[model samples]
Target: MIRPDDETKPFVGRWNSLIRILLVESSVKHVARAAMDYANLYDGTSCHPSNERLARETGYNERTVRKAWAAMRGMGLAERVSHGVAHRRLSDEYQLVIPESWQSLPVLGPSGAKFTCVHCEKAFNPTGNCKVHPDGRVTFDLIPMVFCPEPRQRKGREEPWCATEWDGQRRASGETPWSQLGQERWKVFHLARGEEW
Candidate 1:
């Protein structure tokens, strides 16, 4: 999780990855931006804003805002911490979360040890055409897409997902942007790879 006022490198990196890489829908991105503004001015962990306020801030209709909220929740970016009681006239509160899968990813692009392949022990680039093998041989036929041997799950954290070549192929083929395949499909993809979602 990141606070809206956080200025640290790690926080900023995670924020950049979320807003720039993970979020694909424009409306969802707009709502997320508005939520961040509210989060900075409001409480640190959560923000309470009515749908109308979000709509006004994003220049979107209430329905669009609602859909964006749902999409954000599905993306594991934000979740409602508290629901408003209509009779009491309270507003919903939401807390932004950094998905475990994104924690080890590079802020700008694939970098560091998180992208290293378990098979070749080589660091793979998410958007590249080739990679240097362990024998110091450059392979032009391979795209250097990589994944963890298995899902990395801590005691309480959500399962951390590493990218595979299929993800790169989808991006290369222009089928779907990574992380925008919707929640169910993303889960199925991981589960198919023997990761328990």
Candidate 2:
């Protein structure tokens, strides 16, 4: 379901190597690069020419796209999204999915009680992953999301998330990069652990 404008419009006439693939390359990396060029932007979300869509658009063997996509995923150039069981259409191909800053997570201070997430200012009580996408998709906030509803203070003194400072902030010691916190880890940190380190 990658829209034509998805890549073409954003990068705008810069197909570069991919255009070459669209013309005369079939090497996994090259064709995959072509497919990736379809994404054109790395907004921390998966975007691209779905192998199926690419097969339709470029007439390249799905396997070529699949291999290149696999390499891209290995190279950290793209992300496979969660499409539930329905996402199984391509056992080898991975779709680009974005990791949005919404989900279950708690806000902790240097010490003390944690606060809840109130996205768009709706009073969302404790729930799995803390984020409730109206689309039934769950998301978790990353790094307190700058939307942390409360800041750590003395006992019973959680301040607003908007007031927290993020200077020099980093993934907890020995913690995985934020992007690597996939569904399970993300769920635990934000939903289960309530945004704790």
Candidate 3:
């Protein structure tokens, strides 16, 4: 008997904020999920999964898998690392590019007036000092932290509803986020949060 788990790889490591952001903006849920699954299997820079394998793992048809792959690549989430093997056709490797620095710009929402986070669900106004891009566009650095469904537990303190504390930490650590910790420790921290390996 071919069990469902047998067809799918264990999801490990922290999901990239960019992927979550894309999922919110994606019109097709299945395709977004497929993209996420592919990202979970990514090894540092790339992952190699045949269409058949992705279809089996994501429970989507091969055509859907191909569409999902193309969509993700088009959205700048996945990049083809290599072409198919010569003569014999083979799966192409893809690199997952997670956006680290996301700009916060003003966008009109259903409420008519609100400053929403360009990357995620969180909302914040673009005040204080802003960075001006080469195209004459301005952006803020008040991006929310990566999504963490569980509330943070602190001694004698009320837990916050969402994971937004990373912003301060990132600023304190200088321009590069997660630069304070070593790579190994960072992985461990992500694992503790239920992120994939």
Per-model tally of clashing residue pairs: 0, 19, 6
Q: Identify the candidate with maximal lDDT.
A: 1
Ranking by lDDT: 1, 3, 2
Candidate number with the higher TM-score (1 or 2): 1
Query: Across residues 6-124, which tens digit of lDDT does each residue of candidate 2 receive?
Result: 44434323223222212122354355445555553543234534566666666667776665555444433346664324355533334433212111212222222343442323233
* Model 1: colliding residue pairs: none
Regions more than 4 Å wrong, model 1? 1-13, 40-44, 103-197
Models 1 onward score TM values of 0.47, 0.28, 0.37
Off by over 4 Å in 2: 1-26, 37-48, 84-197
The digit string of per-residue lDDT tens for model 3 on 51-77 reads 777777767788767666665564444
Error in Å for residue 24 of model 1:
1.6
| Candidate that scores best on TM-score | 1
